[model samples]
Target: MTVYITNAKRTPVGVKDGIFSTIEAAHLAAPVIKTLADCSAVPPDEVILGNVTGPGGNIARLSALLAGLPQSVPGFTVDRQCSSGLEAIRLGAALVASGEAQHVIAGGCESSSTSLRPEKAVFSPQSIGDPEMGIAAEWLAEREEISRKDQDDYAVLSYRRFAESIAAARFTHEIVPVGGCSVDEAALKKRPIERMAPRAKSAFQPGGTVTALNASAFNDAACAVFMTSVEAPGMKVIASAASGADPNFPAASPVPAIEKLLMKTGLSVSDIDVWEINEAFAVKIIYTARKLGIPFEKINPDGGGLALGHPYGASGAMLVLRLFYGMQQRNERFGIAAVGSAGGIGVAMLFERV
Candidate 1:
């Protein structure tokens, strides 16, 4: 059986304490869910959402209810840190392909400004080293011998690409207006990236290459896609893979996951037309591209988390959403979305235009 993603949407990415600070994660997700459900014109049998810093409890259920779905339509939430959203979409594809459901809604949401900030959750055993995300990215860059200038250059490119996309209005249709903010907050707040990126001081370690300008910020947003077993004009789910790596180098997790996915599908790097590898850190893209021999231009052509802000769980789904629209615009045949989580875990999915 084949599963098709018929529709997808996301709320505007909001910077920390920016336009969406007062909104909750579920609420941010609700509008997007409602849009997808309404557009599909088919009540989803299940709704699954990936969330990182929600207000506890079942946020997927809350968001589903808030979207005015019938109580019979059950919902659940999953957490794999950064990869939560992609995992949810992968599960939705499984449900449709397995004949367990006719239609499903899956994605992720994050409200970093409003969500509780408890003590950090344990990602790996202490012996394995569970460094904070920034520290881990810093270490990964250092280990990969990535230079400060290279990371900063990548960061500048991300900002430039994002700004250019906004100017071209490429993202207009994919965004669902919420919180009275139609534009992504980070897009508006972007400083003179070219000038600041070079002078930005190290954010994690003294003299460390990783800096605030080159790393993604905590953001609030939500994204989801409608999946169905029935054939349609949309991207078809080809395959998915989940893999793990050293906890201390969580940013590099996507490398193994994408490798596993390619191995599973028996496809090579050149076969993929577009790549949506999460840009939590510039090093993530640098390392993955270098390892996989993928061209830099093919990855996140609309910019990535570095410029748009990373809304944790939702950022993963954002990758799919971008791929869906991007492939359509460019008339591409194959695309892939890959995300690395905080716990040395990664998820990658392949999609082909149907």
Candidate 2:
């Protein structure tokens, strides 16, 4: 049994302090579900969502409610950090394959702007040190000998590729228009629709290569991909896998996930037509691609999380959606999408055009 992707779309990547910062996380997700429902003509009863930030009241249920899904419809929220979105799809695929569902929607969303801040350590507890994700990436860069220049170069390639893809209208078919005010309150007060665009200058490191031109800024966006047991004119999931590494070495986590995916699918790097590795940081992507023997040219042809902006939970599903679109445009057969998250978790999924 195969689970087919019927439709998919993602919100435009917004830079931090840019277009999305003003939007609420739940609001960000509503359009994605609405888009899926509108495009696939699927009812709300079949959808499930992945979310990481909101704790008490599951944002997935709230998002569905906000999307005007009937109260009788059931929705589940899942959290696997960065892998949440992809995992949601994995679960949906399994349910369909097992005959539990015929149609479903799975994806994720996040707003770093509203993420709850942890309380400060008052007593300097020895076992309670929780480092921010960026700091972890910095540590990984140092350990992997990945220079700032290399990171910036990779970022440049991502932006250039994304820009080229947009120019080619490669994403026009896949990206549905999100009609709503910008997340920014001020912007919303002025415009009916907020269009997001690339930044003019980089903000990561001054006089460095990781300019705004190639890196994704803090953004507020949502995306969803619809899956069904019914065959459609689209791609399907071949296999999916996730792995956990020692949080002490977060950057190296993706290798094991990719390895497991390859083993499960009995496929090699050469067998894949395209790769979408999340640019959690320059080193993580660079290291994983090099180890997997994936050609840079075949990797992230339409940009990646770094260039498109990482939306925490939504990124994994977004990667898979982009890979499906890429395969469709190229008339390719197979592709892989992977992402690394906090706590050294990683996920990888394989797809095939039917």
Candidate 3:
């Protein structure tokens, strides 16, 4: 059995303590989940959501109830750090393939502005000290010989791409309006990219290449996709895989994860039409693309996390949502969505345009 996404939607990424600050994590997801089912015209049998910073409990269950899903609809939460959203989707697909479910809603949600800070030390076994995401990216940039200038340039380009899209109202189709906040708050939409990109202060270490500007903003957002074993119109998942690595260098995890999928499917890098690698940091995409021998032009044509924000769990799902629209717009065929998680984990899935 093949699982197919029949509908997908995401809240505009909001800045911490910004548009979505007053909303709780589950509440943030209610509208998206509800609309996903509404648009799919197929009620979900289960709801699976990925969350990292929300208050403890089954956020998926709460969100499902809040979305007005049937009382019999059971839901659960998955915590895989940055890969949580995509992990949820993988789980949902397995359920469909294993005869566990006919229809499922799976994605992620995060209200970082109101959620408690996550315990970084617990992310990995104590050998490697817990380093902040920005710090890890800086280390990777230095290790890979990616320059401050390159990272900054990439960040600016991401913002520019998003800005162009916003001007054309390109995201109107996928974004769910909430709190009257339709505009993406994290992208420097009001500012010129050239002026703001170079002036951002280094946030993690002194003299570090990763700056507050180049790194993804910690954000609040939610995303949901309705998937079923029945085929869909535009896209269908073809392959999926996950891998784990040394927790200290989490940024490098996506390479093995993507390779694992390709290896499983007997496909090569050249077979993919579009690559959606989450820009957790500019270095994340930069290193992963170079390692995979993929051209920059083929990656993130509409911008990524850096331009908008990293709403933690929501990012992975957002990547797939972006790829869905990108491939549709380009008349493309095969695409991949991949993300590196905090515990040195990687998740990647290959999708073909139907």
Candidate 4:
């Protein structure tokens, strides 16, 4: 069976304590889900969502109900930390592939400003060194020899690309207005990254290259895609893979995951026309691109988490949402969306324009 992404929608990303601060995760996701379902004109058999910081319940079900979905449409939430969103999509595609469901609504939602958060989620045993995310980025930067200037320059490029995309109105169609805010809050706030990146102080460790400007900020957003086993006008879900690396090197996890995905699909890096890897930190993109030998220009063509903000659970699905529209813009053939998460886990999904 083949699964196709027929429609998708996402709320404009808001920084932590920003526009979405007052909204709950379920409420934040409901509008996007309703928009997708209504646009596709297909009642989803199931609703799946990825969320990391929700208030401990079936957020997917809550969001589905809030969207006025029929009670027969059951829902569930997946939690894989940062990869939850992509994992949700992968599971939806699986349902279609297995003939268990013809149509499904799947995506991710996050409300960092409102959700309950633990200081640390215990990714690994103490002996294994469960470092925080920022520390992980610091380690990856030091190991990869990614200098402060390199990360700073990359960050500047991200902001610039994002700004350019906004000017071109590339994100206009993908966003669904929420709370009277139609645009991504961060996009409206211009930053002089080039002027401040070099002068920015280390955020994680002494002499570390990781800084606030080079790292993605906590955010609130929701994005979902409509998938169906029926033939449709969109991209076909090809395959997906998940892998793990050492917890201490979480930022490098996407490499092995992408490798496994390509191996499973029997495709080469050169065969992929576009790549969408979550930029939780500039080093994540810098390191993964180098390891995969993928050109920087081919990755995150519309910018990434660094410039758009990383709403943890929502970020992975946001990657697919961006990829779906981006491939349309470029008329690209094959693309992939991948994310490396907290517990050294990584997920990658391949898509082919249809």
* TM-scores for every candidate against the unseen true structure: 0.99, 0.85, 0.97, 0.99
Per-residue lDDT over 118-234 for candidate 2, one digit per residue giving the tens place of the 0 to 100 score: 332222123643455555566666666776667767766776676666557676665544544423222222211112222334344343333343334555567788888888878
Cα lDDT of model 3 by residue, 100-181, tens digit: 9999999999998888765553777567755767777877888899998898998888888878777777788999888887
Minimal lDDT window, size 10, model 1 = 113-122
Relative to the true structure, candidate 1 reaches a TM of 0.99
Model 4 Cα lDDT, one tens digit per residue, 59-86: 9999999999888999999999999999
Could you tally the backbone clashes for each prediction?
0, 5, 0, 0
Q: For candidate 4, what is the lDDT?
A: 0.93
lDDT of each: 0.93, 0.71, 0.87, 0.93
Q: Spell out the clash pairs found in candidate 4.
A: none
Residue pairs in candidate 2 whose N, alpha carbon or C atoms collide under 3 angstroms: 16-218, 22-183, 23-183, 202-211, 202-212
Error of 2 at 242 (Å): 1.1
Report the alpha-carbon TM-score of model 4 versus the true structure. Answer: 0.99
